[model samples]
Target: MTDTTTQKGDQMTDAPLLTDRATRLPAGSPDPAEDRSASTGLSVHGLRKTLGGRDVVAGIDLDVAPGELVSLLGPSGCGKTTTLRMVAGFLTADAGVVTMGDRDVTTLGPERRPSAMVFQNYALWPHMTVAQNVAFPLRTRRVPKAQTAERVRAALELVGLTHHATSKPTAISGGEQQRVALARAVVQEPDVLLLDEPLSNLDAKLRVGVRDEIRRIQQRLGITTVIVTHDQDEALSISDRIAVMHDGRIEQIATPAALYARPATLFVAGFIGSASTVAGRFLTGTPATVGADDTVLVRPEQVTLCEDSPLRATVARVLARGHFAEVVLAADDAELRAYVTGPPPAVGSETGVRLGEVLVYRDGLLAEVVR
Candidate 1:
């Protein structure tokens, strides 16, 4: 279950590699046979992979429109990175077709495909200067000196590393090193860009800034892109769309707003955002009380504290969360968490829990009980 063949160092937690050959980075210019049009899209159909006799990626199908940035968001061992590797041609699919635009690239090698990947560890050679690292892809193809130098300069400028072009990767900050990795990935002007947990190594504050820079660069390039990350915030902020994966399957895929507001499964509802699940029944009559068969998802930000309400609970804890206070309440043998802006009710005091916005499901998976 340990893969050392891929260039993305420690990028995939413990996924097994079927091959020992490392996926070589793209060299020189894009493939002339590969369409470099603005309309070129990336598609994967019926993709499946097995490692160590276990199915890691099971029948995954995804499509990314040109100029769109999509993220495969999932926790460890969920097969998100495995799927990305297959798309990048680092891992061959056990079953399925990977297509670029109208051509089937299911059997293509990593270097033959019109795609570039930014590795998790920033994969820059420690001995090379920033400009040299960015230009290495061109050098691999033996691109002319003038063209390589010009492309390297443009790539460095795109990632805002122009001033540090002569500096070795070890001389720069972690964030700068990441930008250099990005520059190297995009210097070839590939039709698609792949990012493998591209910001996992940065500090919390730096991740925010670097992620923004990535999104900005992606927009400017207008190339089809796929990013893999376990961080929901990173996925939500940088992606035009996100695919939530679990247990070797895609749970849901949608835009950030839609995914957050209307999660398709209980796993997604709970994973994409914070939620407190309370099991109760749907009242049939007017001003009805909660019954016992249904489960309700109450988002903290949607709940409010109000006086003179039918539903009551005991405040268990109160926490100040910068812009709002998190009030934890015990109600009907379930804990209800609410986010409010005003002073919170004292702990151990009785208060009313408001159901301002709630999603009720009849079954554990797919029945919509209420909106």
Candidate 2:
């Protein structure tokens, strides 16, 4: 079940050639032509894992273009971290192949692979200074003393920690420690960088700062980066593309805007952003009629409230957000939420409800309609 090379035959085929020259396909077969091209910076093929007789990662495939920052996003135990670890060479896959550029490193150990990883705990040695920590990788590779110092200094500077080069991990801030971990990883100039929830330990105020810092550094280095995180905001804010995982399978992989606007699955629609589901049925190909069985997903921003719209609803509650007020409305056994930028509407007041860009789903699948 271990695939170690990329097969060149039939580029349009979804079947992947394993090390044993066997074709492995995922459940609910997806068209091979539909998968992203392998000209990608990183390609994962038929990744599968089992723990205690339970499939943890079931036949996952992904492609990350060169210099593309892709995020593996999902709730806890959704195999995001497990997939990251398999790519980093920390865990062996029960079935699959991992490729970086033109190299197949599926069986390669972490130290031997051309990739670096930043752990969630920062993994900084308390006794070592920032410079020494960053220099550890170069020293392991038997790099010249002068070159090691130069690379360490350059990495520290890249992360804006030049002033704290001699500082201990305890003396620096949490964000700074995270940077040190990043500096250490970048000093190696790895072909790919795997980040496992690197910002989860920071405070909310500091999270934004570190998030921006990481994105800036990644872009500056032009390194192929894959971040594993469960935070929707974190993935949406920085990733070029996001892979939404559910129960060890990728529900959808698309840009943030596409994922928010046209989700491929019901799980992705509910997981990636704030949404309210209302029962509805498709009146036509493009228009849907509210019903009791079908589920219609409406984003808060997609619902509009006006004084004279046709549909009337009673406001059940209003919660004020910074720039907008979230008003919950009940109409015909359907509960809808809307984001109003203006003043909050009075509770229990009758208001007109208008559907804005409604996305209809039936049987937990996206329904295509021609407008």
Candidate 3:
């Protein structure tokens, strides 16, 4: 995608391009122009919210560039929606500042902010045609008829829904309705797009397709986006960065690969993917020792079987898939599961297993044990 920017007073035409390869500044790279412009597109500082005398969003500090996709990922009721609402000006933050470019919108109403939101339910007007739905925002802004039609057509085409312009919301599939909603938001050409579980209503197969489409559209438009989702895979698949929330607090924020490979906390490690935590002790040299209460995390792929290995474990169960099998083992009162390529060992078989790559954490702190 390509962006053409025209600097004017308060109304600048900054068109963002979305493609497979979007250009980004390298980490910690400095740009004098960006510093002068305060080009950080979205900033949430010290955001706090409460509901029924309980703190929903304790505090959150986040930054998104002009064309970045960030996801707030966590289980249900972890305050992801509250934070998104705060950003979109749907809810006022008790103590914080929400800034888009240089404007502080913490106290602004939803309609006053230069942003759009796509709800989980699609929230399209059943009585309106796709074109009308896409043009709703432009109409609200009192845009001219010809201009509204042109922008609506462009937005619909961007979302691959140009052909459905005449279809009502009830006549289209769930995914198409969602595309209409997205097109509506895009027609406004807001500075940011806030998505609240936008893909949750679609079926499993459609969810995958729609998510890819959303990512493509977001990148193409170069709009800063923040998505709230409970599905970890969904967030990891589409987001440039993920902010994991737990207990109304932001736990960790990092790139998808970094968050998966080197999780900052035990909660993040367990929440991001499937992992097995085994009791073990860090030995001074050569090999680590197995013990109780000293948990070591290992991905299923980081386990291998060998007859000559020293660890003695009995195969308790075998769950076989097409390409790989999960072998559950009982070793010295500790239960662990290992992923092995090929056929699995039979139940009740005594097997020798070797640690492929173990991440040893003692007292919740990562330690440099030799093994």
Candidate 4:
């Protein structure tokens, strides 16, 4: 599984811990020459890690260009986090290599590698002040006091946490603490930044705000980044591309739009977004090579409940979700969901379904159907 491929030019916030979110640099913002990887970008070649007599990461290969934000997304125990750990030099790979530019750091220890990792727990020392916590890494390197202060201040400013620099970790909210962790990671300006579920600590409402802050900082810095998370919405919104892994292997890698619009495999289609798959005859041309009976994968938003539509389904339930209603329909043996505006039809009433974006696939391969 050893393969080497070069990639290039592929691709947060806080305001006062909240202000950066509102004024984040737009996507494709200009990055300084030094922030951009001039000599090397992060690359994983046939990386494998086996533990407990089983392969946790089996022959994985991924390339993240300078300034790109790629998310390793999958359910727990799917090896997304393991892959990030290996890249950070926290875990040794059983096979394959990791390179930053042309330097092979596969055998390097965590501190020896040219990377910084922000842990899931926000690993801030309760004994230290916000400034002190962010400055710990610099102190270890024996950085000059004057330069360290400047860098620390700059980092705190980047995450909009300068005002809370003197406060202890216990004194701030979870969102503010998370920003402190981010500040620590970027204080040294490493070649790559690795985030391991950085937003998991925050509440549901805070998650989106914090997530937006992260994107703002990443875009502003233009540093290569790799994030590990199981949340599809997080990956979809934060990443330049997503690598969906399953069973310790990469199932597919594509931009969020491409992954959702044209999933290469059935697994990717099912994993990345919601859809109701129903097997129906290829009324016209088959999407697959063999022309076998295919399934139509229709998203809930793609479904329109119209009175004049030819295809009808019985309304089983309708759950109002503020802006739209999640209407569940029973069409023959298939149970499907649709998003419709206004009040839902009475339970057991019939409604027509007009599907907008219909994807046809056969034997797990994307195919075109002329229905």
Model 4, span 1-371: residue lDDT tens: 11111111111211122112112111121322322343347899899988898898999999998778999988889898888889988888889889876668898776656578998778899999999999897676544566567667878886778899999999999888988898888775666789998887778887887788778867776667898898999999999999999889999999999999888878888888888888754222334443337777777987888999777799999888999889999987787899878878889999887767677787788876333
lDDT score of residue 78 within candidate 4: 89
All candidates: TM-score:
0.84, 0.82, 0.82, 0.81
Pairs that collide in candidate 1 are 281-291, 281-292
Error of 3 at 107 (Å): 2.3
The C-alpha RMSD of each candidate to the native structure, in angstroms, is: 8.7, 10.7, 6.7, 8.0
- Candidate 1 residue-wise lDDT at 339: 83
Off by over 4 Å in 1: 1-34, 160-164, 167-176, 282-293, 369-371
Better of 2 and 4 by lDDT: 2
Per-residue alpha-carbon lDDT of candidate 3 for residues 108-161, written as tens digits (9 for 90 to 100): 777666678987678898889999998886666555565556667777877778
For model 2, what is the alpha-carbon lDDT of residue 320?
A: 80
Instruction: Give residue 115's error in model 3 in angstroms.
Output: 1.8
**lDDT of every model, 2 decimals:** 0.77, 0.77, 0.75, 0.76
Which ten-residue region of model 4 has the weakest summed lDDT?
A: 2-11
